[model samples]
Target chain A: MTSKALENGRRSKRHIFHKAKVNRSHAGNAVVFTCILILGAFMALPFVYALGSAFKPLNELFLYPPRLLPQNPTLDNFIGLWTLMKSSWVPMSRYIFNTLLITAAGSAGQIILASMCAFPLAKHPFPGNKFIFRVIFLSLMFHASATAIPTYIIMAKLHMLDTYWALILPACASSFGLYLMKQFIEQINNAVLEAAEIDGANIWQTYIRIVMPMVKPAWLTLMVFSVQSLWNIGSSTYIYSEELKTFSYAVSQVVAGGVARTGTGMAISVIMMVVPITVYLITQSSVMQTMASSGVKE
Target chain B: MNTNIKLHSLQKRRLRDGITGFLFTLPFVVGFILFIFSPVVMYLAMSFSKLSLNDAGAMVFENVKWDNYINVLFEQPDFLKRLASSLGDFALRCPAILFFSLFIAIILNQRFHGRALVRAVFFLPVLVYSGAALMFSNDALSNDYFKLLSSDSDETVNLAQYVISVLGGTEDSPILDIVSTLMDKIYDITCSSGVQILIYLAGLQSISPQLYEASSVEGCTGWESFWKITLPMISPMILVNAVYTVIDVLGNPTNTIINTLYSLAMDSGNYGLSAAMGLIYFLIIFIILGAVFFVINRFVFYEENI
Candidate 1:
């Protein structure tokens, strides 16, 4: 009877109301917090395992079931990676240099070319502009693989196979890039470009001196994107030449050494993967938001 | 005469600007013609002709009269089954990954320590897992991942054989069927490559924070805010991811179209047939992409509202 009376008193009080309110909110937050932690871990797992594997020795790797962390960790893997990278039959540095050049050239080339073409498509009233833009736009709908074989044959007939042009030239004028860039620059006020033109800025001068600076952030964001893409490119199983390989291709070559082979040449891969990753970390920190947004808006 | 000359010069200047604009775009025009347009036209030509790689090391071209297309589509062994399976798998996987990624992305979009790091980590799979990289590192990732489902097989593959053995030991038990079904589900989820997650994370971060603030002031719960604000805002992105995912799946290593192309070109030495198959694949993708664009176009909510 006394417990019932106390419960009745509690149920009738303001203190009870405040206490229950806090309790309900706490429960809600706790559920969200738990979900966030699990999701974060799920997102972070690949990097963890990749880092762990880079540091781990072979014995730990080939264990019946994998363990999450290395037991007897050492820097031997890094040291081995350094030397093994240099010892590769092919010139590793040339491949690295070529990849960097291609990536830079491609991204800059695409952005400039796209920006210029997009200006007219978005701002000007040129005859056949919409038709031409539509042609480029519709080509994007065509699956890349569908064109891969035909493009390969085309490159062959032009005597451009197994060359840098083969790798870089095909994607120079990207349909997706043009569409994206046109949409972006279109959002800018024509008044802005018109004002610049009124101040003795010719079309070329207006684009270079004014429009380019305004879109600087988008440029960096796209560059980072293209770098990340160029870093991971390795579709050259058909373009077979040992000398004409990129880092990703080399890494693939190592990992896919043979059916039974243990893929001992991963020292090069361990080191090479770090280069792009490091570059990405440095550049992406500032514009990660921008890169994310460009993709988002698209 | 002086006024006439000035007017003529102004007209000449306007003409010059148009010519310069065309010239500025000339490199791209040239590239488009040489790389994209010409190849497409050439492929059409090559499709109708049997471009045999001759003994003398040149394309021995002969007109095949619709035979290549007919054979690849209707009569090529494993063609229809493989194509259907690829398409079905793509359909089943796309939505599941889309939802899963959005779920994870929303969770990441919440304020937290290491927010930048978390976003970068989410983006890593997209950066690191190129088609070649995946083909190589799949062994590494899968070997580790496979253990989450079952113990070491003493053999690597042949999942059905293991199922039969488990059944044999249990003698047609209900538990065996349950285990197999659950295993199948796990495999299905794991097989979804993680690109969808990156795409969704990009979409989530694009949502303006002000919307959340406004929604909160209205006494909206997190769930309500998500449904009301976030979903509609990122619908365009979802469409882009869907389209990209569908098209990207065709080029994936396990894809049958890619494998068939590889085999026909290299093994059969019939580049003509492969070209025809490619055309068919491209045609199919074009149709599907058009439908997707039309579907998404009706629902796009532009940023002007926010």
Candidate 2:
């Protein structure tokens, strides 16, 4: 037993030594860093260009060799966009409010419902568990457009045609969120859950307390995806009311206003992108923290 | 008598567990039936029928049997051709996107200075490539700029061609064709991979540090640990990402099949033909997903329940 203990100590020391060597490898680190930097810049180019173009004056927008950075930056585009929005039939703030309402409700509902559904499917053995999962998986294979008309008809029948529920309800039912949450939940060790059960915590309580907190990163990632898609929802066939249109729909209108509104269009793009990017930034730190502690030990 | 009583309670507990499980999944089951399954069934029916509006403007379905399918499959000049090419593109790009995103995810998961900023930059594509920003970037002025940029790269293309010839490969060789196609599509691959990278990063982080520690204690190298431990641990995510990539690529707005279907439905007002085409597209997607899921599922290593 003393010899076994000694061997274990030596092994751990060697492990620590190896880890230090890996971390202190400067040449490999430099190569990885440089590659990431170059790729990051390449990926960020279009967004940076868009930002610059939003600030460019009219003539600068039309420059033949389009400048990556606007030579003469101005706020004219933003001001123009404001004026254009002010002249619209529906108020700009209404569009923003509509988008916020839809995105918030849709994402929250999806995360909650998907997680609630995913827990049982992931952990519990029921009569139709596998069948339900298979169905959900199959649903994710097709594009949403294939179901658009029939969904519209269903919405009409339910008398939900013009309201925000038209958008929120369908998003709440999205198969992708359930699938993602299920996968993440499956990574959790069953022992943690069994311990909870032995403590007399019921299924629902355990799910709320144990499963939900454990899979925080999954739901957060789902939020990013849900918000991104819901925020970008443009004119829908089911919603014909001008008051019910989305901010993206309004932005598309400004974009459609022809060549003269190019500056304002770019400005609107910046505005539209800011919300989702901000959402990602705020949640990213939490996502990383949760993921760090998410590992299950045998 | 005591054992019989214990068995009765055991059966009751199982019954409770089953009911509770069913109740938990109730919301999704209801939502799926109402929203997804019903619509899919309706679309299938529409695919096999002639959809026309009545005087009251309600849709009328006249049974057309196989006509719509026949028209889409054999008669439409560009439909089959576009489908074939799009499938080919999907075959090439799905694996590329998966590999590239995994590579980027591994890099991002490493501890480094300015990691958060680099991550934010990497996720920029998910923001800018969707909605209004995409439309803005595809505007005429930007298109002109891109055209000019390509023209300016003529010298670089010539140099590449000369190098290829020197390497004993013709410009139009199949290998060169694939390489050039991939080269041209690098921006697209990068743009479409943001969410994928996020998924992978999450997957990477969920892998227990204990496994790595144990492997290191066994004198395993970093490379070996990656293949043996990390790969198996992340295989489930690989399945998820693979399915997502396939669907995303096929359903992309710019895909030829999608564009053709859109035009057939909206521009030409041929709903029946469009529905038929959509069903066919969905079948292809289902087949591809099934193949991917089957192959990846076999390799996916789920930790056994304790």
Q: Pick the candidate with the highest DockQ.
A: 2
Lowest-sum lDDT 10-residue window in model 2 chain A? A289-298
Q: Candidate 2 at B281: error in angstroms?
A: 2.2
lDDT of 2 by residue, A75-181 (tens): 99999988888999889999999999999999999998899899989898898799899988998866777667788888889999999889999999989889889
Estimate, for each residue in B189-283, the C-alpha lDDT of model 2 and write its tens digit. 77789999988887887787778888877788777888998898888789889988988888877677877777777788787889999998888
lDDT tens digits, residues B1-306, model 1? 999999998888777767766666667777777778877877777778887667888667899879889988777878778878888877777667667667666666666678667656655555545422353453434423333112222434323234356345543568667766665554344335344554455455445566677787765665677788888777766765666666666556457777787678768878788878877877777877778778876776654434
True contacts kept of 2: 0.57
In angstroms, how far off is A148's CA in candidate 1? 3.8
Q: Model 1's A-chain: what TM-score? A: 0.76
Clashing pairs in 2: none
- Model 1, position A223: C-alpha lDDT score: 59
